[model samples]
Target: MSSFPDYYALLGVTQSATTEEIRQAYKKESLRTHPDRLTKASSAEKKRATEKFQAVADAYYVLSDPTRRSEYDVLYASQPRRSQDPNASSNFFSQFANMFAGAAGGSGAGAGQPGTPPAGQRPDAEGVFSDVFEELLRPEVERRVSWWAYLGAVCGAGVGFIIANIPGLMLGAVAGNRLGAIRDAKGKSVAAVFNQLGGNQKAEILRALAMKVLGSAF
Candidate 1:
């Protein structure tokens, strides 16, 4: 459980570093600490380089965004953090696991009482999922290369699918758009049944719309 790294220190720059300086520092340090460059290093050294690389990425993400950068500039090296409490860590894990399991809809899980999950059980599904999501989604800890590769693959598939079913998709949209004309009780117009789907179905509908919208625009 490491505390947050100093964004300036991680980038090998002073707190007063300008945006250009920060960008240059990230380029330099990222090149040095990249995991690929450490492939020949010992296993421990490789892990250290990976952590360092992640820290540098995190720092750059924070400092590059104007809103977050302003916030960090104001708060950096100035705010006081609570002393690291070993007991708090264990207690937090206990509460977090039960809440997560309940949220995950697992059986036999209580709704997370304070100090619940015993000290012994391995890190629960909740904690691991949260950490993975945080690392993947946090502007400060992006998976730059991996994420772009995934986006490229998905966009490729989307294009292929749109080309294959253009006619059918257009028909569905025409039908959906006409849904507003139908009337229900008390002379009020009820949106066509298709518009009243639950969240999952609504997501499917929006995704279909997105493919069509993008296809036509392009």
Candidate 2:
């Protein structure tokens, strides 16, 4: 069963990001893990970088297209992901129609639908999420890491590479300490994330988590 990718999350941009912002973010992010940067990585790591690069590219594509972006917002944002069935990808038009029905009095929007939430008591955006998604799961967002992580890594790599340039005992130390630490940490984080998806349901959540992560990364 096919699942929709969370486009916004992939670009590390927000749903509210403008075209300019999206382009800037893609440009900035694409530079860091570019396959070329994986000069010292094993072939496997390079391949992984290549795939992530593609996901980033795909995110930029859909967001850059106005029509697709609108449809994506309507389908992805308007539709609640947790409908209980892991494999269910609801029909876009059907959800849109449901949204319309809700916009109207929701009395089945003129049918004898018993519960017409009163006009004055109209629910807020939060309620909108409740009505659309079964469980209304707000993404569990953790802290936004400081820019220092990237900066520090860049600084360390530069200093280490320069230090490793000088042959002899110092070079050996840089190779063992600096380069090794970076190699280990990058591999660990990357491996932890791309670890196999267990069951279908877990895969679905992980797929969703990937989007959320990709969004944050950008």
Candidate 3:
């Protein structure tokens, strides 16, 4: 056995404990020894609890992964037993600190490397809009528009024109006035209205608006 604290012992689990058992033990130990749980304790007690909590977390991080666990098991088995070293706890903590420092340094280096945009420089608004637009249009583009929709709108307008040419214009003007009043009451812009629509509804509205704009351009 190694002079270092046994991870399994820290978690209160056996060497042959299953992954789920190890996870449960870690969760139980972590909650019990967490610094927050020592709110009423003395300063010394709180500090000790914090250290124990960190150790439990670190142990779980290593033991939960098969590769790391295997490596640790071999290294642990090869070391002198805990009884042989009076300074075993200090030695274990020193090694743990070095391991944590190395991990942090590696993470920082990877995050700051060239060819990757820094966190502050990354595009957010434009990227989100582009993603949303692409997703919304995907189904519409995949499934061709039905001719019946165009035909229905055309026939409805034609019938209205035939029935009362002058009254139809007056009626359209009244409807437009009512819609404007509703929009003003809501205090919502065209973009806000479009955003409130479901995906399919938005796609249809956008397609019609886009076609109207393009048609006027020609």
Candidate 4:
């Protein structure tokens, strides 16, 4: 029998993991395997990371939704055990690739298609994965930078006007935009650092970020 991709194992989660748990697992796995985080890696390593990243995204999308998760759970339960087989890993990924390729309607038809995912299962599979990647890498405070920059410019202008006069408005806008850009850079730096940390360290950082987000929400 062919081996199936173990979504739970891929994300390091249990089959019984809660939705929130699965979400958290995806965040952890996605960050670790993100291709951008492996710029210094060998070509092969980078390719592997990219594939793993896509797989992680696919697993999260499937497991996060109720209906899909239920379906996956059943399939997973029914798949025969091949953990002892050395070929299990390769077989799993082979099927994984084929699954997405089929989703793209096969090689002949999909080859000419632009913006098609390497193993795209659905027309928008790549799009969904992109969204997930963006969400995962986004800085805590910089989630909506465009909106924040606009608001910041307005506020900065108001503050500047009170301090100075006509010239202050223009100065304030430039300053606001500059400050926004700086913060965004800092956020990116933080994410980079987070990516380099050990597993336990990452968990701590993720926990802190989660707490801060939750605190602000309430």
Give the alpha-carbon lDDT of every model. 0.42, 0.42, 0.48, 0.56
Candidate 3 residue-wise lDDT, 1-218, digit = tens:
25676777787888898877876675556545545434357998877765665566556655655644665677678766632122443456455433333233133212222211222132122122222234343444333333334444455455556767867645544554555444433563333444444555644544443444333211
Give per-residue CA lDDT, model 4, range 34-60, as digits (tens).
565444579999777666666676676
Each prediction's TM-score against the native? 0.36, 0.36, 0.41, 0.48
Q: Is candidate 3 or candidate 4 better by lDDT?
A: 4
Of the candidates shown, which would achieve the greatest lDDT relative to the real structure? 4
lDDT of 2: 0.42
Task: List runs of model 2 lying over 4 Å from the truth.
Answer: 1-3, 78-218
lDDT of 1 by residue, 49-139 (tens): 6556555554655554454455555644554442223232343333332333322321211213211234333233222222222322232
For 1-218, candidate 2 gives per-residue lDDT tens digits of 23455657665778899987776565545444345444457889977765565455444444554644665577676544423121222222223323433333322211112122333221221122122221212231111112334455555556656765544344455445555445434543222222222334333443354344354322
All candidates: CA RMSD (Å)? 17.5, 18.8, 20.1, 10.1
